[model samples]
Each structure stands twice: as C-alpha cells, then as structure tokens.
Target: MQPHVTTALQAWIASWTAHERAAQDVMEAAFPGLKPTPAPTGCCDVQMRWERDGEGSGTACLDDHGRATIQFEDVPKAAVGHAMTEVFGNGWFNEGPDGFAGAPPGKYCWEDDCTYAECEIDIGDDGLAAVAISYVKIEDVVAILDALETGLEAVRPSA
Candidate 1:
C-alpha cells in the first residue's frame, strides 16, 4: 500500500480499536493468514492493502481530509450479499424478489446529524463482486467495517 493510504487506513482503524478488535476476531476466523495493521496515534488516515491464502484481497483507504473507503476485490458475492442483508435489513438493496440473477448493483445511503455514509456492491468483469463502503463519521466507519466483517464471517465456510 502507498504510504499515504497506509497512514489513512491506520488512522481509521486506530480510531475504532474496539470495533477493529471484534472485526479482527471475525477476520481471523474467516481468513487465518490475514493480518491487520496496528493503529497508532497521529495516524491521519486508513489506507492499506493485503492478501492472504484462502482469503481474498482488498484495500482500505482514506485521504487526510475525506471519507474512508474500502474495497474487497475478490470477495464472494454471496457472503457480502448476506452481510448486507443482515446489516441493513431487507429492502435495502433491490435485487428484485428472485435475488441476484438479474439484479443490478445495490446502493444505499443515509445520514445522521453531520455524518453521511454510502454502501455499494460492485460486480467485476469476472462475475464476482466486491463490497465498498464509505463514511464520514467514526461510528459509521466502524459500523460499515463491522458489518463487512460480520458478513464475511457469515459466509466464510462457503467462501
């Protein structure tokens, strides 16, 4: 990962140690070889990338003065879909009643006070999908990542 991205991700992760720790357990359970970078103080952002055997690859990033962004390139569509359903409840992503076959990508957004967050699912050319979450508030960032972590855990076996 680039230095700036690394710093950004560090900051973001550091800011959410409690949530990060819980997610770490989920991540470890799902992908044993994967390791997360420590979040030290003065870290300005959350930007890093990693890949592990038996697990997929992804990037987490944020600029010095912007919202946090995460992308899991090789994530299993089913796992992420299940996570989204669990996190946001039903009716969040409109894939029709039949499910993903002809469903377009899902998009959802919400705001609370001064913070805003957006979640999306991007389908790659390989027919696999990646989950991307961006948010401004620290809580939203944690919630998004936690949902992802929980979601990934939910689907780890099949993945």
Candidate 2:
C-alpha cells in the first residue's frame, strides 16, 4: 500500500479502537459481566454476548455510527409474537413466503414510522424464536436491552 493509504488506514483503525472502547464501557455499565468483543462481522464495531441461565443466548452489536442490532436465539417459540408486540408495538405484518416485503408466518416485524429503531421476531423450524432489534442507537443500549429481556420474560416459563 502507498504511504498515505497506510497512514489513513492506521488513523481509521485508531478511531475504531477508541470507539469500541467507549462502547464497551457503556455496555459494561449497563449490563455487567457481559464483556464486549470484536464483532464476528466487519460491519459492526463490537459485539456483546448475553445469556440467561435457562432462557437462551444472544448477541448485540454496535457500529461506529451508533446503530445497534441485537439477536436472541433459542427463546420460546410462543414468545415470538409477544416479543414483537412488546418491543416494536402493534401493526406488524408478514414479509410473505420469500421472507420479503415484510416477514413470513412465524415471523413479525414493525418497520413503518421507525425513525429511531425497528424490530422483528422470527420462529425457526426448530421451534425456537429469535428476536432482532435493529437501527437502535447505541446510547439507548440499556433501554433496548431491558426491552428485549422484558419481551422474553413475558412468555418465558416462570422460575
């Protein structure tokens, strides 16, 4: 690579590193014990893994521009609708057979008038539901996290 290109790349990496550190600090303060790490994909700056003893596991990612996407796996299938309603509110629609336009059966999504965020809930063939909270601000990570936990708890078996 050219000298100037290398310098620019280094600067970008440094900025990204600093951003990740700041994001991790925010996440740690909000959700203790869940450490933030580099996301498996290049699209995101960092990812935090979450798990509840008997509930399920999930990952939350944040990008440099403060966009966040969270996914929860292995949740109760019945919770799919409840979660979608709780997190994204009413007026969800199916994306159709090809999983386009909206979301197909066993899946629900809220995409209209989402200036801040949008969310979806999908139940796989394995009988487990997955929740996706997208376009959320990283600064509101705590709020989204709380919403997700509450949505899952709404249908999870009581202890």
Candidate 3:
C-alpha cells in the first residue's frame, strides 16, 4: 500500500516535469530570484539506509510522518528557511505567516498527521531549517511566494 503511494508520487512528479517548464515559469513568476532545482535524490531505496552524513552531507527519512530531510553543511539554513517559508506559507517563521505556527527548530520534524508538513535544519545557534530541495504543494508554494514578493527582505547568505 505504501509502496503504491510512493509510486504514485513519483509518477506524479515525473508527469509534472513533462510540463515542468510551465510550472517553473509559475514558480519563477512567484519568486523571481529563487529557482527550483531538480531534486538531486529521489525517494528512499535499499541504498538509502538511515545514517548520518559524517562528511556534512546526508539524508534522513522521518518516515513515520511521510517526510525526509537531507542535511547539508554551510548551506545557509536561514536563507533557505526564509525562502521556503516565503514560498510556501508566507514569511512565517517560528510561527505561521498568517498565525500558522512554523515548524519548531531542529532536524526535520514530520508532523503527526503528515498532511502538509515542513522540517527545519538547524544551522548552529542560528535556527533549525530544511535539508532537502524541499517538497511542497505547488499552489501553496505559489501563493506564499506571491505574498512575500510584495515585502522583500533580502537575506545575505551566511558568511
């Protein structure tokens, strides 16, 4: 059953790419500076065992909640966090953009219900942020970003 769901998600994403250019255009229109990159890795397979990326790169699957977060070193968690929030749920951080609570700071925390979720990848004392390229609903991403664009606050990458 779960495998079928995963298969369906993959098929959906693949189909998305067929007309992805259009989606990209939409995403671009929403967040002009930000770009949606191809997912470097896909769903977990046999080779994707749960483990730490000792070299500062690794993937962690919070399967119980139907989500995963891949950590990266020196990747500017805040920048990514703000970008994701602005893109998905307005500029909601620490809490939601519109009174919607943001995901708490930590390694990614998949929600209990597993409906719409997010994860934070802590960048030291800064705060918890996301790990992956981030998987979010297309419409949500677009709506939130459109709002954020109106209130741009350029975040300089961590030095």
Candidate 4:
C-alpha cells in the first residue's frame, strides 16, 4: 500500500516524542534512506508539535543576519536538502502549536490550508513523488495547510 498523508504527518509528530537517541530512531523509522549526522551547532535547529487532526513540523536555520529562515527538508537530517527542499519548501514554519518550538520540543498546532493539500516528495532521478490529500471540510484544508504553497521558492531553498 502507498504511504498515507496522515501516516507521514504522524511520523513527523512522533519524531519529537522520542529522546535524542530515539529521535534518531524516529528519523530512521520515518525515512528508509535517511543518513543522519550529528546536527552541528548553529547549523540547524528543529521544532515539532502536534494536535488532533491538525499537526505539523519544520526546521528553521539561523541566517547570517541572525534571523531565522524557516525551511522544510524531506529528510530530518536533510541529507538531500538540495532535492527534497526543492520539491516541498513553501511554508513559514510558525512559532506556535507544532509550528517551531526549538528542537521541536512537544505538542504543536498544525497550520496549512485544507480541502486540498499537496506536497511532492523528491525521489532523486525518478522525479517527484506526489502527496495530495482532499478534505470534505474547507476548514480542514485551511486550518491544516494554511494555504502554504507546496512549491519550492527560489529566494531560498526548494519549494
């Protein structure tokens, strides 16, 4: 069976529940091909949070200007950031409710537009693997997705 959107969503939520070692495990568990390295200090930071039907996770790096530039990578380690972020990187990575709470500590609110949510997973040379989900309620789409573009933006990393 194909991987479900909720499954991916849950996997993202579940990653924060685990300890450091366990976070590595959760990372490995979420992506079969992931290769994680110790996150260098000042290089990367993580944020995780979860809620009922609406939940999300993201990572934001500190820019040269000391500003936080939020970006989404396919793998937790972002080993293939060039590829993954390119396919799925149009989000603000908010600060409340599973938005971005530093090392992705616990519980968060999911922000994304509902009705029709979409994100493309990059699979290297095979092109992009698409993940699109439709909802009966428009609020589900709005509240969950928050009208975030699933496309990669050129200003920074992938879309």
Best by TM-score: 2
Task: Flag the better candidate by TM-score, 2 or 4.
Answer: 2
lDDT by residue (16-103, candidate 2, tens digit) is: 8887778777766655535666546545757787777656677778766767777777766544444444444445455343332123
Candidate 3 global CA lDDT score? 0.42
lDDT of each: 0.56, 0.63, 0.42, 0.30
Query: Of the candidates shown, which would achieve the greatest lDDT relative to the real structure?
Result: 2
> Candidate 1 on 50-74: residue-level lDDT in tens?
6744346776655454455566767
Query: Which ten-residue region of model 3 has the weakest summed lDDT?
Result: 46-55
Model 3 bad stretches (over 4 Å) = 1-18, 35-105, 108-116, 121-123, 126-134, 144-159
* Residue 152 in model 4: lDDT: 22
User: Please, what is the TM-score per model?
Assistant: 0.53, 0.58, 0.37, 0.22
Clashes of 4: 29
lDDT of 4 by residue, 31-121 (tens): 2222343445445332222221111234322223222223233322222223223333323323223222121222212223642323323
Ranking by TM-score: 2, 1, 3, 4
Name the weakest run of 10 consecutive residues (lDDT summed) in model 4. Answer: 47-56
TM-score of 3: 0.37
lDDT tens string, model 3, 1-159? Answer: 699999999998777555445545665576555443334436532112122222123333222222333333443344455555555444333443432224444443333235455544454444423344334545654564455344333443234
